[model samples]
Target: MDRITKLTSEKPVIIFSKSSCCMCHTIKTLFNGFGVNPNVHELDEIPGGREVEQALLRIGCNPSVPAVFIGGELVGGANEVMSLHLSRSLIPMLKKAGALWV
Candidate 1:
């Protein structure tokens, strides 16, 4: 169990992504910019990371590179993430997950 898995299985916010993914990098940067520490998993490195992969797959996700999971819930791809951000809902959701500071 790596840091990401441990965090996902325990923490409130988890992001599974690949190193080459711009969306992954971007979302992470945004969280960091907000002074938030989000747990990250890079599927490109882990073997049999399919549980997370399959979870995303069930939602008709097109392997767009980065998958965001909140409180062990799959929140969808980058666009969904961006949508939440634009609506100012992401931070509130994070707070609900206890993943954000007050």
Candidate 2:
């Protein structure tokens, strides 16, 4: 498995994102609201972040920043996250993944 795969599997929630992206921040904030300290990989700040992004794309991810993963599964991007939240699925997912205690 690649670094991304390994990390995603290790963390209950993980976000591969860019620091400057508003959607990224939004997703991060949403997780925080749920009291989840998601493992965040800031793409723009790392030397080979672009490559990792490309790798994620090739693996059929959102091909953009704020790629959220739960239990090693791609949970899509910002809009997906918001939709899940609105539908009350996000919390269940978090709980199933052991990311949310309450």
lDDT of 1 by residue, 1-102 (tens): 343445567767778888878889998898778777887777777775666567556666677358777877768778988999999999999888888877
Candidates in order, TM-scores: namely 0.80, 0.93
What are the lDDT figures for the candidates, one per model? Answer: 0.76, 0.89
Best candidate according to lDDT: 2
Note the residue pairs that clash in candidate 2: none
Error of 1 at 72 (Å): 2.0
Worst 10 residues of 2 by lDDT: 56-65
Lowest lDDT 10-mer window, candidate 1? 1-10
Residue 67 lDDT in candidate 2: 93
Residue pairs with backbone overlap in model 1 = none
Q: Using TM-score as the measure, which candidate wins?
A: 2
Model 2 TM-score is: 0.93
Total clashing residue pairs per candidate?
Answer: 0, 0
lDDT of 1 at 69: 75
